[model samples]
Target: MGAVSEPLIQWFELNRRLLPFRQEPSAYHIWVSEIMLQQTRVSAALPYYERFVAELPDPAALAACDPDKLRKLWQGLGYYSRVANMQKAAQIVCRQYGGQLPADYAALRALPGIGDYTAGAIASIAFGIPAPAVDGNVLRVFARLDNSSADITKPAAKREFTARVLEEMPKERPGPYNEALMELGALVCLPNGAPKCEVCPLAAQCKGRAAGRAEQLPVKTAKPEKTLVPVTAALITGPQGVLLQRRPSKGLLAGLWQPFAFEGTAMTQPELDAALRTIGLCVQWQAPLQSTRHVFTHRIWQISGFCGTAAGPAPEGCVWASRAELNGEYAVPSAFAGIMRQWRPE
Candidate 1:
C-alpha cells in the first residue's frame, strides 16, 4: 500500500453513504447494486435495487425469472441490456458455479456484461480480493491526483491507472480501499469543473490541485454527436384502456413494453390511423400532446405524443392495459414518461 491508502480509507469510513447494499456486503447484493449503479445515480437506483433484490434475491432466482417479468422489473432504468446481460450471467452462475458469483476476477469477468471495472468491483468489494475498480470517477480522481495527461478513453490509460490504483490498494482491506476511492471520486473529486478539493482528504497530495489544473488533468476524446431521431408515441385509449406494444425481443429497448410508437418521423393523423389499420384496428384521432425529448448514449428521441380512442381486439403481441394494469402489471420505460403523464395513469 502507498501513502493514499490510510487517509482515503479513513475518509470513506467517515463519509460513505448509508446505502442499503452497503449494510449487507454480500456477493449477490454487491453484484446487483454495482450493475444498477452503472450510468445511474445511487439515489435513482435505490428503489429499483430494493425491488429487484426483493424479487430476485439470488442468482438462481434471477436465472429462473421470466423474461417479461425481468424486463418489467428493470423498466424505468435505461440501458435495458444491463439487466438482460445480468440475467445471462445469473444463469451461468446458477448452472456452473452453484448460484455464487465467482470470487476470482477472471471468472467473474467472463460472465455476460461483466467487464474489467465491474469484475474488479465484485471481486474486491464482495470477496475481499486485491483489485482495482477504475470507472470514470476513479479516472478523474487519479488523473488529478497524479496530474496525468493521458487520454482517459484509451485502453492503455485505463491499464496504467489500474496499476497505479493497485499500488495504493491495501492488501488486507481491499474492499474498503476500493470503495473509498470510488466514494471520494463521486463525492469530493467531482468532474465537469466542480471538484470539492477543500474537503478532499487527498488534496494535500494531489498534483493537479497543486498545479492548479485539476479539471484539465483527465483528458478524453470528444464524444460522438447524438443523432436526433423523431418519434411518435400513440396513447390509444378505448373501453379496455390504453394500447401498449411489446418491443421486439432484441434491439434497442428490447423486450420492454411501450405505448404504440413509431421511430423515424412524427406520424400525421392519417398515417397514425393507417398504422392502426395495419395492426387490424382503427383509432379516432383525439388531440396531439406536447413534444419532449429522451436522450440516450448515441441518440436523442424527439418525441411527439398524442392521445386517442380505439376499438376492437388488440393486434397480435400487444395488450390493452387499463390504468390499473399500467400501474400494476406493466413496466413502462421512463422514455414514455411524457406521454404517460398526459394520460396521468396514476
Candidate 2:
C-alpha cells in the first residue's frame, strides 16, 4: 500500500457507519455481506443485511431454511439467482466445511455462491489473506488513477485491477489497508461526474485528476432501454372459491400463485374475463378493485385487477381455493399481496 492506505484507514476508523455487519462480525456475516454488497451499496444493503442476518443467523440456519422462506426473505431484491445460490453455498458450508467459511481463496471461490470478487473479499476481510477484492469501487479507483480509457465492465480490466491490488497489499495490516482503498472509492469516488479529489487520498496520484478527466476516464458501454409489460388480473369470487392461477416456472413471478391473469395490451375487465374463459372459466360481472404498477429490472407491470362472481363451478382454469391459500401457501408477488391486504377476504 502507498501513503494512501494509512490515512484512509484512519479516516474509515473515524467515519464508518455503525452497521450490524460491522459489529462482532463472523466469517458468515462477512461472507453474506460481501455477497449482498455485490453491485449494491452499503446504504441500500443495510436493511436487507439486517433482515437476512436476523432470519438466517448462521450457515447451519441458512442451510436449513425452506426455499420458499428464503425467497420470501429476498422477495424484492432482484437477481434472485444470487440469493438462491447463497442458500446452496450455505448447505455446502454446513455439510462439507462444518459451517465455517473456507479460508483459502481458491477453496472459498469454489463455493456455490462465491465468485472471484466474493472469494477475495471473504479471504482477505474475514481470514486475513492479503487478497485484493476488486469490485466496481476498486475498478473505478484503478481507472481514474491510471486514467485508463478501457471499459471497467470488461473482464480484462477486472483481472488487471485485482492482480495490481494483490501486488500492492501492504506487508503488515493488509486487511484494513485493502478494505480502506475500497471504502474510498465507494464513499468518495463518485461514479458519474467529478470525484471529490479535494478529499480523496489518491487525488495527487490520480492521472485522471491530473489531466482533468476524472469524470470520463473509466468509460462504460451504453445500457439498453427497459421494456414495459402490461398484465390483467381477476379477483374472482363465488361460493366455490376465488380463482387462482399458477405462474409459469420461468420469468417474472415464476412459481407464484395468483388470481386468473394474463399479459396483454389492455387490462379491461371483459378482456380479463375472456382470458379466464380460455382456461375454461365463464365470468360474471366483477367490479374493478385496483390499478397499480410494479417495476422490475427490465420490465414494468401496469396491472389492473377486479373482483367478480363465477357463473357456476369454478372453470378448469381456476385453482379452487380460499383466500387463506393465497396468503399462506402461495408466494404471491408483493404487488399482488399488497392488493390482497386491502381486500377484506370474503
Candidate 3:
C-alpha cells in the first residue's frame, strides 16, 4: 500500500456512482461498459449498455446474434467498428474459452479490440488480478500527482503512468483501488475546466496542485484538423416508403443503411434527375431539405439532399422501406439523421 491508495479507495467507496456495471462486475459487463465508455459519457451510454446486456447476456449470445440486429443494438453508439470487433472477440471466446472471457490479462489483450487498458480493467475489476488499468483518467491523475508535463498521447507516457499506477496498487483489493483511481479522476480531477482538488482525496499529495499547475500537467498533442466531405443524398420516395441504400461492407459506417448519396456539395435538380435515371428511377424533384453536418473522428460530412417521389421499381443496390421497416429492421447510422428525419414517412 502507498500513501494515496488507502485514502483514494476510501473516497471511492463513499462517493462512487451506482453504475449498472459496478453493481454487477462480471467480465462481460466490464468489457462492454469499458468499450462503450471509451468515447462516450456515462449518462449517454447507460441506456445502450443496459439494452445491450439485456438482449445479449453472454459471450455466446453476442457471438450468435444476427449481424443486422447487432448493428441495430449499437445503432446510436458511433464507432461501429468497436462493436464489430467485440463480436469477433465473442466468437473467439465461444470457440476457445467456452464462451466466457479469459481471466488472464494476456489472453484478454489477445482478443479483438481489447487493448492494455481494457485488459487491465477486466483483469483487475472482474477477476481480482493486480493489474493497472491506466486510461486517460488515470494518466491525468498520475501526471498531476507527479506534476510531470509529459505528453500523455505518447506510448512512453502511458507506459510510465502504468508503472506508477502499479506501484501504488493495493494487491489485496486491486479492484476497488483501480476503480477508485478512475473515479477520482472522473469526479474530482476533471480533464476540462478546473479540477475540484479541494474534495479530491489525493489533493494533498498532488504535486501539480502544490506547483499551481494541476490543470496543465497531462499535456497532449494536438490532433490534425478533420477533413470536410461534402455529400449529396437523394431521398427518393414512392408508394413503398423511403429509398435507403446499403453502404459497402467495409469502410466508414460499414454495412449500414443511408439515402442514395453522391460525393459533391451541390447537385442541380437536372443532375440529380439524371443520376436517378442512371440508377433506373425517374424522380420528380420536390424541394431541398435542411442541410446538416455530422462529425466523425477524422472527417466531417457536410450533407445536403433533396426529397422526391419515384414511381418505379426499386434500384439494384437500394430498397424501399416503409417507416415501420426502417424503424424495426434496418440499422441506419446517425450520419444521415437530418435527411431521414425530413424525408421519413409521417
TM-score of each: 0.97, 0.83, 0.97
Evaluated against the true structure, the overall lDDT of model 3 is: 0.91
| Candidate 3 lDDT tens digits, 200-301 | 998888999999999776899989999999898888888999988998989888898998888645787788788778878888888997888999999989
TM-score of 2: 0.83
- Model 1 clash pairs are none
lDDT of 3 at 227: 90
lDDT of each model, Cα atoms only? Answer: 0.89, 0.74, 0.91
Expressed as tens digits, the lDDT of each residue in 1-346 for candidate 1 is 5699999988999999999999988888998999999989999999999999999999999999998889888888889999999999999998899889998999999999998888999999999899789999899999999999999999999998999999888899999989998999889999888899999999999999999999776889989999999998888888888889988889999878888889998888788878778868777777997888999999999999678887788899899999888887887888888888887442
Q: Model 1: what TM-score? A: 0.97
Candidate 3: where is the Cα deviation over 4 Å? 344-346
Q: Rank the candidates by lDDT, best first.
A: 3, 1, 2
| Clash number by candidate, in order | 0, 0, 0
Cα miss at 85, model 3 (Å)? 0.7
